[model samples]
Every structure is written in C-alpha cells, then in structure tokens.
Target chain A: MKLIGENLNIMSKKYGAALKAKEAKPLQELAIEQAKAGMDYVDLNIGPASKTGVDLMTWLVPVIEEVVDIPLALDTSNVKAIEAGLKACKKHRPLINSIMVRPERMEALLPLAAQYDAEFVGLLWGPEGMPRDENERGALCAELVFKATGEFGIKPERIFVDPIQTPVNVQQIQIMSVLEFMKMFADIAPGCRSTIGLSNVSNGPPDHLRPILNQVMLIILKRHGMYSAIVDTYDTMLHEIARDKHPGLEALVHKVEDGEAVDMTHLSDEERSFVKTAKVIMGQALYSDSWLEI
Target chain B: MTFQPSKQVYSGKIREVTLGSGDKAVTIGGRGVYAFHSFEGAMPNAPRIAMEVWDKDPSEDWAAAAKAPFGDVLADPAAWASKCVKEYGAEIIVVQTKSADPNGDNRAAADVAATVKKVVDSVDVPVIVWGVANHEKDTEVMKLVAESCAGKKVALSPVEEGDYKQIGAASLGYNQLVVASSPIDINLAKQLNILLGNLGVKAENLLIDPTTGGLGYGLEYTYSVMERAGQAALTQEDEKLQQPMIANVANETWKCKESNLSTEDAPELGDAAQRGILMEAVTAVDLMLAGADVVVMRHPEAIKLVRNYIAKMM
Candidate 1:
C-alpha cells in the first residue's frame, strides 16, 4: 500500500499574506515532522489561503523534498499550482491530488501528468456535476476509468480513481456509493488504484464523527481494493481507528508473536489482544488513550 | 516430463460455450481453476470484443489517425456498423444511443429506436444498446427501443440501483440481456447483483459492469477491483456475481484529449490516431487480462489489434 501524508496543515504565510504574520510553524517544518513520523508520502497543498497562490506550491515542494526522501501527493485546486508543484517536485514520481471527470479538467491535467509520468487521482463526477444517485455515479466512475486508460496512455497502476466522498449527513446512500464505487473500480480496472479524502465525509459533522466515518470507510474501501488515501497525518485518533480496521495488522502481529491465534472475529479481541500489544510495547507515554484506554 | 503451475484455470464471466452440434456461444462465469492455467484444466474460449457505434458525428477532437477511416460514415450509425463488420471484421456491434443525450439535441425515443432498429437490422451478429447517461430519459428511450428489437437478443445496459426495475423489466420483456453497473467496491457490486437477482433476473441474463479506468486514470485501482471481483466470483463462488463482465471502451477512449486532440498541442506525443488506438488497445488488453468477458470499443484499428491479440492467445 502506498503511504500518504496530508499536505500543508500549519497556518503559514505562504498560504496567504493574512497568514504570513501569524506565528504558525513553517510548511517545510511540518513536512519534515510528518516524514520523521514515518509517512511514505507528504501531501502538499496550497488551498484558497495561499498568497502566492500556486507559486507557493512550486516554491515549497522542493524545500520539503530537500528535507524528506518521501514521495509527494500534490494536493491543489489550482491547475497552475499543480503544474508548478509538479515542476518543483524532485521525487522520481508523485501522485496528483485529483482530476475530476470533466473533460476540460482531464484535458488540462492528464497531459501534465503524462508529461511528468506522474500518477493522478481521477474523480467520477463530470462537467454536469456529481449525479445524485449511486448507479449513475458508479457508471460515471466506470466511464472515467475508461477515459483515463483508453484515451490517455497513463498506466493503470499510476491512476487512482476517487469515487467522490459525500458527507454522511447530506446523503445516507452516499455511504453505499462509496462502497459500490470501490467495488466497481476493482472489477473494471483490476490493476488501477482507488482513494478518497478521509476528512470529506465528516465535513460539517462533529469533530468525533470524522474518525469513525473515516475508519469504517477505510476498512470497507481497503477490503474492496483501495490501497491509498489523502488524510491528515496529525489525526492520531483517525490513524488509530484506521489501524484497528486494517485486515492484516492482527495477522502480521500474530506472526511476530510466534503465531499466536488471535481471534480477530470479535471487537473484544481487537481491544484485548491488539490494543494490549500496542500498549505493552509502545509504553503509556507513547501510546494514545483512545485505543487502549477505551 | 511435465511442468506444472500452482494456480488452476478458472473462468470468471466470459467463457465460450460450445454446443454438441458444433455451434459456439459465449457465456461468462465458470470456475475449475485460475485464469489461463490450461495445464490445470480445460481453458476454453478467450474473451470477445465488440465494435462501438454512436449516434453523434465523430467529434473534431477525435484523433485524425483513428477517425480518417470512418470519415463520412461517422454521421450515421448504420453506416458505421456496416463499415465495422465489412471492413473491420467485428463479431458484435455495440450501438450507443448518444443521440438520446438529453443535454444535447434531445432526440425523441422514436428517433433513438429508429437508429437502434437500423443497426440491429444491418448486422447479423449480436448487438448491445447503451442508453445515454440520463436516467429518466434513458429509461423512457430504451424501453421503446428494447421493445422494438424484442427477442432479437440485444444487450441493454446501465441498469443501476435506483433505475434497475425499469431497465430490468424492459430487458425481460424484450428477452435481452441487462447490465448491472456498480461502483468500484466489491460488496456493493455483489449487493447490486443480488438485488437484480431478487427481481427474477437470472444470473445468465445479467452482465456485471464493474467500471474501468484508463492508463493514467486510476487504472491500477480499477484493475485491482476487477481482479478481486473475479477472484471472489471464482474462489468464493458468489452465485449472484458470477455473470459476464462488459466494458465500454470507445466512450472512455475518445474523451481524453491526448487521444482525441491533435498532436500539434503536445508535439512530444506522436500521432494522435495511433496513440488513441493504442490507448484503447492497451485498456482492452488490460481488462481482458484482468478477466473482463466482453469489451465494447470504438475505432476499427483498436478492434483489429484486440482481435489479433485474442487470436495469438488462443
């Protein structure tokens, strides 16, 4: 599985002139921290806050790359920023945050990807906007896969299709769509990858809602063949939740523990055996109270 | 004296059925071993390819290399089908009713039906009728068209969760095959198939479209999903999901500007037509390798390339 770290978390001047005078840690420092924290790739983004706009991405990407050897997931809404970021990136190969199903958007972004030999996240929604229904959305997703592979020469392994996660509060069936889109992606493009913004589904909900939704979604997505995601590296609660849901962690730990038969079928087994193992080895100071204390 | 591979040969959606009388028919879903492991057992029938025809004029953005052959015939579906069969050697013709696009000219159901009838009548091989993406309009348009070609054994697609009832009923009434489209997830794919099954739609009458991605468009993710689904269908033996798979190649292939736009835009990229054809060919090959039973594609060159590959594999 490709490891991904969230981009640009600290309030920085590069984000905007208004934020420039703020005392937040530099973006470069934050990236180095994430790298030291064991992230495989640092997600870099210059959202609406950035003063230099896309120029900041081009400027900061190299600085972050200089400090860390990890690959980058270039996260930006601005096309020019993506281009600049792609140019600035020293990593051999980077993953583009996304190119939605809109033809114009795909036309603009996919060529840049092809030029740089970069991987991309292709969203399912087209110029008409996201379809309200699951089947339609799934069909659109299927269509995007076809376009990405059949029209563009991008390799299947390099592409990651995002099914466009919707907030649970807005639409309940969207949960089903997420699951369905993951399955459809597996069946149609067996070699392609799938991912989503872990934080998107919980947007506008309570702070605690994010972790639970992300973990459940992650487990189902992973089971269905998704192997990568764009998420906050600082969200330890969410990370723990994801760790608990991972299908192979227990098995791997069991192998390490001299093949102890861990009854992974029940939630209690996860609490007793898995949580206990983490606590014993990592110590109370290192481990969070969320998984073990619960 | 002999070398043996570990995995067995299993067919998941897209096996060729041979009748006692020497007639050959294609069916999907049979599992005795893993894919392409003939040493383990009989691995009969490679996947088949379907040529695509649409109602709209071949857009200017289409690669000149691929579009030159179809030139004037691109305007008419019947001419396109005839050209594909006579010139391209297509075994099956897939006609996408793009003229039914609600956002576009919004042609009436009768207009869509007329085109479908013309294409169906023009070809002796089996046909697949794809509805435009609009749900309400597709339901309204496809019903009359499916009825028009009743008992002729056409494949009608894109029956999703919200709209399967109408499309499924239409397919049943017409004695046609229905495609069940699910997103990239496995459980939902299974669930949708199960839902279709509950509606009295036999597994054989259904084709599972798991959705696909092109080369740069998360194709690996799509490949993994399809591979897992195929594995699940065979190893887990989920009855509902053990249907043939269908992928519409042309619709996706033509959309990418790299394939469709002129090479003048990106000189570093060579020959738009060949590039476009190659993209489709690569996508078809990937899907086939990943266990897709049927591929619906555009461009005669791509069709030819896939056919030759299939021949070589056989």
Candidate 2:
C-alpha cells in the first residue's frame, strides 16, 4: 500500500535560461519546490530551443542537485541533451525519459541506460508506427522487452513500458486500447513498470478539459498497472491518487484533470466521511509503511 | 391457390473477410449487407466495433450519461475494457495511440508497442493498433509495432495519402491487416484502396475507412460517401473499393457540443446524455445501413442501441 513516488519534475530549456538571467530563478525554484513539495523526481527537458552540442546538464543538473537530493527523470528528444543531463546528474541512478522501439534509437539509447544503470521507459511502437490491434501490439511489446532484457541486459524491473497514448479526437478506440494494454503489460510483464505522459490525450480541446481527461486516464492507467506518469508535478488529482487518500477522489480528480470546476457540494457528509476515512486508512496502509525506509 | 408473402430480410454490420491458405488465414469483419450483397446477401458478421482509449485522459466534457457507466473504472484502461467486455459486450478493442500526437507526450515507438501488448493480454478479443495521425511518427512507430507484433495478424492503419508505404510495408511484413483511410470523397477512397493494393497489401487484408463526421457535423456527408462507396462495391463491383469499411462513431459524436454539454446550458436541448447516445447510435446505424463493416463507437448505451437496431434489422 506504500505509495511509491516517482519525482515529477518539469525541466525545460526555458527554465534553464531563466535561471541564468536570474529572471528564471523562479522556474528552477519551482522545480525545486515540487521536489520539496513531495515530487520524487524532477523532469529535466532541454527542448529544441536550447543550443545544440552544448551540455546543459553538466551545469544545470548540479545546480538543481545542490538544492534538492531527489532523483531526476532525464527527458529530452535530443540524445545529446539527455547525455548532458545524465553526465551532470547527481543521483546515482536516475530514470531515463525513454528509449523507443526504433532499432537505431534503441541501439544508441539502450546502452546509455545500461551504462548508467538507470531505469528506462520503453515505448511500444518502433520505426513502423502503432499497430491497429492488441495481438500485434502485444507482440511488439514482447519484442521490446526481449531487447531490453536480452540485448540491453537491463533487468525487467528497471524497464518501464509506456503504451503510447493516442489522441481521442482521431483514433477513439485507442483510448481503451491503451488502458487494456497497460493492464496486459502488468499481467504479462510483472517485473517491468508501466507509465505514460498524462497530458497527451486532450491535446486539441479546450484547455480546461485536459486535466479532467488526464485524471480519468491516469486512474485507468493506474488500475492497469501504470505505476507512474510524466505529469504536472503539482496536480492535486495526481497527489490524491499517489497518496491513495481517497479511492473515490478519482471522480473529483478526473474532473480537475479535465479542467472542470470541481463542486465539492455534490458530496454528501457520508461521501466526505468516506474520503476522510479512506485517506486515513490509505496513509496508514500505504504511505506510513514507507516513511521509515525513505 | 393461395399466394405466400416474403419476409423483410434484415442484416447485421459484421462481415468476415478471409485471406491466405486454409486455417493459416486471416478473417476481418465487413458484415454490412450493402458492401458485398452479391456474395452472401448479408445475414450476420457485420463490421466489428472498436472502443476508444486515450493517451492522456478523457475530458469531463464527455456526456454525463457516457461517463456514468465508466464510473470509477473510467480512469483505468484495463478495468474499463474488462467492464466493456464483461459488462458492455465489446467484440474487438481498438487502442488508439493518441499520445503519439507530436504536441502531446510525443511518446516513442516502444511505448506504443507496450500498450498494444497490454491490451492484447487483457482479453481474448482482437485488438487494433492505431497511430495518432502524425505521419512521421506513424512511420517511425508502426515499423517497430509491425515487427513487434509479427505473425499476430493485428490490423494497423489509416494509412493515408503521404505515408502509406511505411505502414503498408510494416503491416505486410507482420502479416497483419492495414486500414486504408481517405477523405469522404469516393474517388479518393478508391484511390487510396488502389494505392494500398499497389503496395502488395491484398484487398482481403485491407479495411477501407472513409473518414467519418458526426451528427450535425456533416453526418449526411459521411452517409452519402459511405453509401456511394458501398453502392460502388455492390453494383459497380469495383474490386479496389470493395473491401470492408471502418467508421469511428464515438469520436465524432462525442465532439458534438450538444451531446456532451448540460441541457441547463441550452434549455432547448433535450436530455444531453440521451442526445449523445442517440447521436452515436444513429450515426452507427446509419453507417451500418450505408455499408460500414466496422463501427467504432464510445458510449455503451449507443453501442447497445446500435446492436439492437442491427439485430432488429437483420
């Protein structure tokens, strides 16, 4: 029942410059604040805007590390940026944002993950694209796991598979497919972890809709063995689930995740009492158990 | 000297397309009667339904009626799907890779593969692998997806104008089916079919998807195109366009603000949930009648209504 908290850090090239100019101090401080606020990892993303070939991680990671000791999830589309961050990372074993199923990318990144002895996120689709059905998709997942464990020599426990999230506007069935797949991964590959980016599905809609959808999707993903996700570190909905304080809190969390105004008035005293009771039980059963270890 | 009257025969939307050698073959649904009536005249085995799943989360804008069944399970895919199969009766599950959207998680290929595998393991029903409409990402992810699902016979698709080669080759290599999508234009639909054919993906292995629009958002356009495409398959007998059809009903219906919003916001509106269900149901049935082999939808109530309508019609 102990809630395992993965650091939820949002690191960006935008924040890095802000830190240098002193104007960005708040952004870095914000990330540090998230870590202080109970995030297990602060995600560092040096987006495309950053100068290429320069190792920002070598400099920035230390600064963040100086302020907080939490683990980091090195997130980047650029291989160089990831390497820079990894090189400067203070934590002994940080989580790699991802290594996709593409042969070239996997070949390049898997070794890095192995060399660092880091936990890695493995996407299901490779160079071809997402398949249309579960059987083929499952086969694809098996192949990735095989490569991660057999070829990369990484342990299953260290590998987290991200069943890529598709947009609801286009491929509607994919939403259910992802949740089913998450469950399948958990059942089939118990040693490995499952996770996803929490904000991808509601990409095109009104801004308010995103969080509610995310919360609902997260709960589905969590039930299906998704142990972690790359989400806004400060999201209350996420905190509710991670804390396991209220099982029904998912309804409210989903509303918030979707950007809907949460009306606590809907809950009766009985429901409110249930949430309080659940929170106490969850804290005692899940969180309190791990306090001593931490 | 008495004369007997013939009964009005109705057909379902499920169709089965058989390809390859005995037992080592693939069977995909194309059950709508209008598609290829000359062959079997349409009894059962109409097109299947693909349920929706998202990469991030489904928004609250979803009609309360649609969201009600999902309840607590709405948050998790595995739990939701299990309910769909066990409770709601989903025949085939389609996992849309929406997270692959470039603006979103822009998740890598391995993530797509993992998710596909997870759903495959969750149920006995077949699963569909879908891309998030990013041609570049689809090309990148599907190859790994095809390779990962090798010999499993999953359907990978919506292989549109610019990126058919990558998806086609991957599907062909994996021995899975490909969904060839085109705008509502019948000629364009046929052209895409021909393009898929040229790629060496057989007609039987192809599922034709003429893009769908929801109620009030040009459903008539979709209906006309689908009907024309179906008529072409039946009367004109165009082999290229004769393949099964897949229509996404839930995506379009849910997008209609009328279906998801509260009636209180619009007093003229009837029951919003019922309206949403009706929109999806009507769209699904209309597509089926128009010759859709597969009707992918969201709301369970809508699915039930469609199923019952198909039952009554057949």
Candidate 3:
C-alpha cells in the first residue's frame, strides 16, 4: 500500500501549536518520521485554512520539504493555499488533497491542478453532500472524473478517487458502500488510483478500540483495491499489514471479508480481535464500546 | 476516449545491479516499466543471459545436445567458461557447483572455491558461482568463494532464507553480489530479499532467484511469481522486491526427463537435440517476458534463440 501520512494535521495538539506559531521544527520532525515510517506521501492537512491559508501553506510546504523528500499532499478547502503549497513542491508531483464533486470546488481547484500538473483526490462527496450509497459515489466519481479528464485535461493516472470513508459507529452501511465503490473504481476510472482517510473509520470509537477498526478496515479496503491511504505515522502494525509482513493475519482477514464460516474458537486472541473488528466494520455485527470482549 | 489501453503509472524502479569489475562488467534491472513495456517507461538494461559452466565434467549427467558444443572444454570449468565467452558471445558465465552437493561428490569448500576462481579468471565477462542449494554446503562454499574471488564482484547464487545470513555476510564482507533463491512464490522471494537487505546487503548487490521451473514443469508457476514480483516492484513500489531477477533456466530445463529421451525411444517427440534446445529457449523467453533480468542457460542454440527474441522485443 502507498501510505500518505495523516499526522501533519492542524488538529494534532503538538503540531497544531507548531502550525499556529509558524515553527518548522516540530512539523519537519513529524515529516521526517512519517517518511521514515514508509509513507509514500505526507498529508499537510491545514483544515479549511480560510484566514492565513496562503501564507501558512507557503511557509509549511518549504519547511517540511527542507527535511524530507516525500511529496506533500496540500490539504485544505482554501484553493489559494493549495496553490501556494503546490508552487513549493518543485521536486515531486504534489497532491491537491481534494476536489469535491461540487462545481464551485471543481472550478476553483481543477484549473490550479492542471496549471501545476499536480495530482488531486476526486472526493466523491457531491454538492448534495455525503453520498447516500455506492451508486451515488459512482455518479459523483463519473462527474468529477469526466470533467477533470475531459475538460481540465488531467490525466487519469494523476487522479486519486477517494470514496469517502465514514465513521463505522454512525454509518456502518456507508463503510460497505465504500467497499462496493472500491470494487467498481477501476472499472469507472480505469487508470486512476484510489486512496482513503483510513483513520475516519475509527473516529468515534474509543481511542483504545480505534486501531483495530482502522487496521481491519485497511485489510478489507486493500482487498477491494485501495491503492493508498492517509494513515497515522505511528501506526506500525498498520504499516506492517500494508507491507504484507503478516500473511497469517491478512489471510484471516481475507476469510472474514470472504464471509467464510470461521469458528471463533479456532482463533488466537489477536486473530479473534481482528475477526470481531472486521465483523463490526462489515456490519456483520453491531458496534459497541466493548465489542472485543463480546 | 476511443478504447484507450490502460497504462500503469509506476512510482518505483528495479535497482540495477552490476556484476564483475572493470571492462566486462554487465548491469541488469533498473527498469521503470514492466518487463518490456518500453512504450510506457524506460527498460534501461536489456535482459542478459549467463551461460552455465559446470564445475565438474557432466559427460554422464548432461544431455547429448547440451554437451555437444563444449567438446574438449567440458573437462575444465575455466576452459568451458572461456569458450562460452569467446566462442558463444556469452556476456556472463555461471559456474554451476553441482559436484559440491552433499549428495553428490561432496567436494570440499576450498576445492570448489579454487575451481570457481579459475573460471572467474578465465572469463572476461561476469562470473556467477551457483551453489547446490544445500544450506550448509552453500554457506561453506560461498563463504570461501566470496573470499577467494574478492573484488571480482562474482554473484553467489542459491542463497536461500536459511543460508542468507552466512552467504549474505560473505557477500557484504567481500563486496560480492548475492542471488537470493526462493520457492516459486512471490512472498517467499520478497521475504528472502528483505532478509538479505537486513544483513546489510545493498540493493545493487542483490538478485532474486524466484526458482525457475522448465517448460511443462511448473513454468507457469514460476512465470506468475516473477510477473507478480515485477508488478510489486514497479506498480506497488515494493523496494525490497525490486532487485533484478535471475532465472536458473539451464539446470531446470536440461535435467527434465524429456530432454534426455532419445528420438528412437519416443519417435513422435521429434529430434532430441532440437526439442531440448526449444524447451530451454522457450523457457528462457517466457522468463524474460515475466521480468527475468538474467537467465542462466546451457545450450548455445537456446541462448541464440532467446537473444533473438529479446532483440525483437527490445
């Protein structure tokens, strides 16, 4: 899996302080750690960044670039800020974090992406907002992708289609819808790649329980052909699974994903946890705080 | 879009590994494309064929067609290697240390090293010393051979998961290259490469042997594994699995019972010599298509045929 580190966000207490203070050291340190953690890209999620978006991104891109060689995913709602970040990405192709299926976002960002020759994620969330199901996601993908490729002249290879990930606790059905969209992504876009905000699946779950949901969701998404993911830099277990180091665990997850009759008694503690977590994500079992114990 | 072909966009490349030192050193791998998909990306180095030279005379074991070209040189490995380079236009020579097998003559490590050194000395091209895959014997023989042939950049083959530590360390110490052998499984192949990398063997000093199987004998399995390895290296950006692959095609192809079956015994099988040559050539070509950087082949005819195929493809 091509990992895009999701740690360099303004939401992080430590890094958010650094971002607010315009301190390069903490952000650069996180960037280096993420690169060393085997991340293919580092997502600089300056969420919405409406106020100082442009200047902050301009400063931030160069700061991270000073330390690590990885491409930075310029993530923000502010179009001007994305352009500032893209301008600093002279070494590699920077990714414009998202171009929502909505016209306003597409019109603002698509030209910037074309002008900079940058890769951008085609966020499936249309003007109607969060897609109802796989069909809606597919329709949004078609609209955004056709415009990006057909009108804006973006190559299909440069587009990364993100079938938006919803928290498992709230929208368990949407998680399955995302998987269904993944199965259809290649057929829809053909050459375009796919990525996800992997941590979103575990967002509302308890901190202790989050990693399992995220990891199991990753294995399932991978089977459905996820090209890359925006993931935590410190998630070593997730990284190992992505690198295919744990074949037995991957095999067990595949069994669960395949809906095979797996006897819970035959599994070890770790294996049982993964199986149960996968069940919750697949909506085979209902979500609860103490799901693992159950 | 009028039925456009889906082209892969690769983020990683196979590391190019140069074998031998100075003048005749040959480099393989370093491709940003799948096999020979030259239209999409660069295949910097064309696949090379390393002609096989046995450490011991193979009059009894080798098929008649395979032994026909060497003639008098078959008795001496150095002479055989020289013949391969000078007469056959072989760019590389692989000295097969079959006699050192614990099951066979069980030649001492020192004895095999001496013979391998002679072969390395005789050939201007790169020399790859292939061990008999017995973990203990390979470890012993390759350690001495790496030490004896220091600075030659000779490649030590059949370095399995069990023996990578000893052989890998030897390669590291002597600056030799290692051909990490694995079963016909992409996961095993990547695991062995990872193990070698952990032993401080640089990517440029490594080669992957996904264990070749001749035509009609698990060739499809070998092909698929190699295809997957190439896919991972180029598309998935799997750095550990991106070392150029070397298929030990000669041993597997020639040793098959069909290669030895006489025309009189099996009239419908056509000429024995031509059949063996075709099998070897077909297997070599198939492997090259599946992303083999180097194919260790025995017959000159087969090598020439494969060279032609590569010429056309490249």
- Candidate maximizing TM-score: 3
For residues B121-145, what per-residue lDDT tens digits would candidate 2 score against the true structure? 6666666667777789888877877
Using Cα atoms with residue i matched to residue i, what is each candidate's TM-score against the true structure? Answer: 0.53, 0.47, 0.56
Which run of 10 residues does model 1 chain B get worst, by summed lDDT? B15-24
What is the per-residue lDDT of model 1 for residues B1-314, given as tens digits with 9 covering 90 to 100? 68864663344333332111112234444534444544665546557788888876766546677678889798888988988888887777888887788897788988888888999888777777888767888898779877888767777777787788888888778667888887765546766777777677776678878877776676676677677666655654444556667777667766877686677877788877788988899998888877777888887778888889878875
- Candidate 3 Cα misplacement greater than 4 A, ranges: A1-294, B1-3
Clashing pairs counted in every model: 58, 92, 0
| Better-scoring candidate (lDDT), 1 or 3 | 3
What value does the lDDT take at residue B124 in candidate 1? 71
**Sort order, DockQ high to low:** 1, 3, 2
Query: Which digits, one per residue and each the tens of the lDDT, describe model 1 over residues A1-294?
Result: 445776464333453432243323466577787886657678765564345647667666777787788888777667887888888887658888878888788889988988888989887777788766667767776777677677877788888877777754444457556766665666766688777776675565457535544544454455556677676677664455455545555443434234344454564643454434332222211111122332
Q: Write the per-residue lDDT of candidate 2 for residues A1-294, one digit (tens) a residue.
A: 112232322243555566445353555576677765577677766554256524555656776677777777777667777777777776557777778878887888888888878887787776778866666567778887888889878899888777777644344457657755765776567588777766675555457545544555566566556677777665676567666755776554344333454455778754443332222122211111111111
Quote the positional error of residue A192 for candidate 3 in Å. Answer: 36
TM-score of 2: 0.47
In the order shown, what is each candidate's alpha-carbon RMSD? 16.9, 25.5, 21.6
Residue B149, model 2: Cα distance from true site in angstroms: 2.4
Query: What is the DockQ score, from 0 to 1, of model 2?
Result: 0.01
